[model samples]
Target: MSITRSQIADIAHLARLALSEQEIPVYAESLSRVLGLVEQLQRADTAGVTPIAHPLPGQRQRLRPDEVTETDQHELYQRNAPQVQAGLYLVPRVIE
Candidate 1:
């Protein structure tokens, strides 16, 4: 899971990053360590383990009651418009 100098250059190129000669080795070492950690995590055994969404147990997600809160003011607001048709604002065509 070790990253090489060429791989680091390729990664920098793909990420649109400008890396100097000194920075290349530094980034390669850091990235290699990250990949090694990920490799170690992949080796862990998780047999019969159930994935949970929330970390806390016996806690249900709170939800607000869905209801209309605002009164319809389309007609009131449309009174200020220069052009409207079929309950929709009319605009001049700009594209052919």
Candidate 2:
């Protein structure tokens, strides 16, 4: 697939990008190459490939256990607040 100067200009305008006249030609060539690569990839045959959730097929995702590691220290922090109720800091209502 080939990208033209007019298409590049339109794309730049739609994206609100300030592309100089010199940069437009460079972008057109780069975008054309990217589209060409995508077209090439689309032609590849993947007849029997199984879709996977994770990139590594057989490995279990290493994750930290669902457990509390930090102690509740809100009360200590709330001592300096002007107002606190039910472990929530009371802020002045600005939007009426």
Candidate 3:
């Protein structure tokens, strides 16, 4: 999992990044450490583990009651429009 200077250069080229000679070694070391961590995690045993949406199994999300709170104002709003048909506003076609 150890990243080399040439690998860092290739990665920088693909990512369209401009890395100085000093920065390349620093990035290579950082990326190597990250890959080492990934390799360590790959050795973990997750055979009996099940994927979960929430961390807490018994927790329930609180939601507001499904109810209409606003009165219908479409007719009032359409009164100011230049042209409307079948409850829809009509606009002039600008493109062929």
Q: How close to the true structure is residue 50 of candidate 2, measured as C-alpha lDDT?
A: 77
Candidate 2 lDDT tens digits, 6-42: 9999999999999999999999999999999889777
Could you tally the backbone clashes for each prediction?
Answer: 0, 0, 0
How close to the true structure is residue 42 of candidate 1, measured as C-alpha lDDT?
A: 71
lDDT of 3 by residue, 1-96 (tens): 899999999999999999999999999999999998889877789899887998898899899889998899999999999999999999888697
Rank the models by lDDT, top first.
3, 2, 1
| Candidate models: Cα lDDT each | 0.92, 0.92, 0.93
Q: Write the per-residue lDDT of candidate 1 for residues 32-52, one digit (tens) a residue.
A: 999988897777798888888
* Model 1, position 9: C-alpha lDDT score: 96
- After superposing candidate 1, which stretches have Cα over 4 Å from the reference? 45-96
Q: What range of 10 consecutive residues in model 1 has the weakest lDDT sum?
A: 40-49
C-alpha TM-scores of all predictions:
0.45, 0.45, 0.45
